[model samples]
Target: MDQVALLQISSALLLNVGFIWLVGSWFARRWLGSSGVKRNDVEPALRKLDLVAAGVSAVASVVALYAATAVMGGISLQEAGPMFWMMLSTTHYGHIGCLTILAMMILFAIRVRGGTSGASDTASLLTIVAFAITRASMGHAGENGILSVSLAAEVVHFFSIGLWTGAVIVSAYFVLTPQRVATLALAVTDRYLNVMSRGVMLAVILIIGTGLYNAWHRIGTVEQLTRSSYGLTLLVKIALVACAIGLGGYNKFFGLPAAGRSARGVAVVRRVLQIESVLLLGALAAAAILTSQQPPTAI
Candidate 1:
C-alpha cells in the first residue's frame, strides 16, 4: 500500500479496536449490574466481568499498537513484525497484569466487605490508565514536544473523552433503566450518573480545546482544512461528534430528568439510550475514517 492508503487502513483498524473496547467495557458493566447477585455475592461476578473485559481490552491494545507502528511510524506491515509483536505482547500482558492485580484487590475487598468487590471501580481506573498510556504511545499528538508532556496532555484529552463516552454507555446500561431495580441499585446508579455527567462535561471541553489546537498545528489554514485528506476526515469526525452531542443533550435535557416519572418517561429514556448508542457507533465509524487519513506533513 502507498503511504496514504496504509495510513488510512491502519487507522481504521485502530478505530475499530477502540470501538470494540468501548462496547466491551459497556457490556461488562451492564452484565455486572444485572447479575442478580446480592452485594455480598457481587464479588465473583464483578471479578469475572473484569477478566472478560481485560481480554477484550488486550485485543484492542494489540490492534491499536500495530496500527500505530505501521501508520504513524511508517513501518510497512511486512516490516512490522518485531515492533508489532513486542508492542502487542507487552501491552496485552500489561493489561492482564493489571487485571491480576485488580483481582487480588477485589478478593481482599470481598473479604473485608463480605460480598462486594468494588471491582468496577478498579476496572475503570485501570482502563483509564491503560488507554492513556496506549494512546500516548500511538498518537501524533503525543509525539509532539521534547518532554512528552504535550503527549501526556493529549493522552489526558483522549482519556477524558473515553471516560465520558464509556460512562454514558455504562450509565445507560445500569442507570436510566426501565426495569425495577432495588433501592440500593438506584442509589448507586444515581451517584455514578451524577459523577459521570460532570466528568463528561469536562471531557467535552477538553476535547474541543485539544482538537482545535491539533488542527491548527496540522492544517494551518482554512484552505488546507478543505483541501487536505486529513482535514476532510477531521471534518467528518467533527460532524459525527456534533450529531452525537445533540443526542446527548436530548438525553440530558429531556430523557434523564423525566426518568421514572411515568411510563412515557421510562419509554423516552430507553429510546434515547438506544439513539445514543447508535450515534456513538456513528461517531466511532467517523473516528475510524479519521485515523486512516495521513497527518498533514505540510500545509
Candidate 2:
C-alpha cells in the first residue's frame, strides 16, 4: 500500500481502538459496580486510561481529516497543504470530518474533566455516540444523505463492533486480570460474566445483520466479490470476523461457564479473549483497506 493507505489504516485502527477502550471502560465500571464490585478499587486507573484513549482518538481524528483531504485532492501530504483549507471549507466530506473531530474533542474534554457522577458519564457516552455517528457519516453511507438507511445501518454496525470487540479487549487486558479476578467475590465475578456474555451475544446478532446489508449494498454480485479489490478485501474481513465470532462463541458457551466456577477458568477465558481480540483487530485492518478501495457497486 501507499503512504496514504498506510496513514488511513493507522488512523482507522487508532480511532477504533480508542473508541473501543472508552466504551469498554464505561461498561466495565457500570457492570462491575452493579454486580457489587467496589468502584473505588478500579475507577481511578480506568479513568486515567480513558483519558489517554480519548487523547489518542482525538489525534487520530485529526489525522483522518487531513488524510481524507489529501485523498480527495489526489496529492501528497506536502503538496496537499495549500488545498487543505479549500477542501475543509467547501466539501461535504470535509464538513462531516470536522464534525467528527469536534465530537472527539468534546469526548476528550469530558474524559479530562473526570467525575464518576451520572451526569458526567452520560455526557461522555453521548459525546462518544456522536463521534461514532459523525465518523460513520463520512464515507459511502454519507453519499446517501444523513437520513438514509445506509447511514443508519453503518451506525448500528459501528456500535455493534464497538460493543463486542471493545468488551473483549477491555476484559482480557484490563478488567479480568488474575489479581482483580481473585479479589472479586464469586458472586460478583459470575454476575459480571453473565452480563458481558449476554451483551456480546446481542452485539454479534446485530453485527451479522448489518454486515450483510453493507456487503450486499456494496458488492451486489458474486462476480464482484471475487473480481474486485474492494470485494476481495471485504471477503477477507468477513473471514476474520467469522473467526472472531467463533472464538467469542466458545468463550460465551463454554469458557464463561467455566469461569463462573473457578479463578483458573477466568485465566483461560481471558487468554481466549485476547486471541479473539487479535482476530477482531485484523478485521478492522481489512476494513481500513476496504475504505481505501472503490467499491464494486460504485463502478
List the global CA lDDT of all models. Answer: 0.55, 0.86
Best by TM-score: 2
lDDT of 1 by residue, 111-155 (tens): 334323357455555544654555444546544542566566666
**Where in model 1 is the C-alpha error above 4 Å?**
1-49, 64-127, 174-177, 180-195, 297-299
Model 1 residue 102 CA deviation in Å: 14
Q: List the residue pairs that clash in candidate 2.
A: none
Candidate 2 stretches with Cα past 4 Å from truth are none
The estimated TM-scores of all candidates read 0.67, 0.97
On a 0 to 1 TM-score scale, where does candidate 2 land against the true structure? 0.97
Per-residue error for 45 in candidate 1, Å, reads 5.1
Cα RMSD, model 1 = 6.5
